[model samples]
Target: MNRFAALEAFVRVAETQSFSEAARRLRSSKSAISRNVSALESELGARLLNRTTRSLNLTEAGRAYFERVSRILADLDDADRALGQLQASPRGRLQVSAPMSFGFLHLAPAMPEFLARFPEVDVDLSLNDRFVDVVDEGFDVALRIGALPDSSLMARRIAPIRRTLCASPDYFRRRGTPQTPEDLKAHECLRNSNVARTQEWRFVDENGKPSLVAVSGRVSANNGDALRIFALSGFGVASLPTFIVGADLRSGALVSALDRFVPQDLAMNAVYPHSRHLSPKVRAFVDFLVARFGKRYWDPDDGRP
Candidate 1:
């Protein structure tokens, strides 16, 4: 191993205090990281890392060397960032991921314009519903929805979203409209199988007490858009995101049930690894999304219906 390469690995190990964590962050294997550190120790003739089965520590010499090398590495990173910023154009292949149907309906429409605006960027976008390992799989950014799992990944809200309880006027006319959250239990509801528990639909009561209503349905679908279509055809009551059903609600094609008990908030987020220096391309795309679709995306009073 080269001198500075070993120093970099040693510094990461020292900072993270785990060879495995340092390896994960560096996108290398634990054995490779351990081997590099050992090679550094062999070349310097001084053991830099004090390792154990459970923990790691830096030797006295390693501490002093770390104090000096940290500043050098910081300077190099700053210089690299500075030079990267100086480039007049962003020129690289940027990989992005998003949900399948949303990518088709919203994201895809804007891409041609974005491409025209930035000739230097070549975007590689992957559309799927499943969560992807961005760092391991080499994605630069991922557009996410609903509750994000706690992780090192960074997220920014691109728009607002809420799972609105909706039914067609025809169904409501026949079955009678629900006046309160409790009434949903008696109604015929279409379940979203994608939800964690298909049998329960959650809502916040008037006092802000959280409640789950056990709902039953004859037809359940994994796709939100399909469930929405079924609801439109007077199949049953369906709860779906505002972005998916907002326009229909405004046009009177779909009407909300138990509107008073509905939660008013959720978010559409742009997620990426929580790196100190995020690329301008990712930053640009998120800003573009926010500018295009803002906080009042589903405001019922808005003309979009």
Candidate 2:
């Protein structure tokens, strides 16, 4: 005799005012319904129904309990429905993480159009070069460049980013271009703080041969944008991403050095948590990134999946 089941049977009989009708509505045998009601009355020590030969009626106490229990169950159902609605709609804040230079140059510019499309979504953006813990930081998605370390995070490739050693024409004019990897030792250089190996750079040629060159620099910065500025100001030769110095190479403001050496360009990615259910907002933003930034500008070099 489950107490809740007995209460439900009692409430059903009171509302319908007939044991046979309550049994039919509840899809249970009439005898089982009667047994549950009897158990409930025995526990309460009160006669809840006035069972007459011709008709059924509720005792005053039964009617009062029915009013309270029915409203409680109804409110619980209403709350569940409200939460279901919220889970399906895309009206909420979406937090995103990205590198500083790319956020300022590429991602920030696309945000206006993204907001114009999904006006209901509030975008919260954080920019940095350090790896972010998406779940701990409460970010919806993170835009990452270069190679990502092995992890459990779900990643979607968006574009390819290439790293190259570049020098301004003024600097090249003054010190001359270094045709061979070893010749870089003779020139002033700009370096990034996170270079995996000091004085060592790796490259994969067009034919897929691998080589490593030891490099040294006069100036080093933790941020790639700073290194780009240093290269532009002729401070030294900077090893930087193609996106930062791509236009400069085409415009002849900078020239690629030791073309025979540099890391292979890599696909950029938008990574997120893998879980049971993705909120509508996360789905919408990823689709927006694919639709907006899914140009061939991504895989410029050897095109492969």
* Every model's TM-score: 0.73, 0.66
Off by over 4 Å in 1: 3-79, 86-88, 295-299, 302-305
**Top TM-score prediction, candidate number:** 1
TM-score for predicted model 1 compared with the true structure: 0.73
lDDT of 1 by residue, 4-55 (tens): 7777788788877889888998898999888889998898889787888877
Q: List per-prediction Cα lDDT, in the order shown.
A: 0.80, 0.77
How many Å off is the CA of 133 in candidate 1?
Answer: 1.8
Angstrom error of the Cα, residue 289, model 2: value is 1.9
**Candidate 2 lDDT tens digits, 118-162:** 788899999988889875456889998777888867888886667
Residue 225 of model 2: what lDDT?
A: 81
RMSD of 2: 17.7
Candidate 2 overall lDDT versus native: 0.77
Clashes of 2: 1
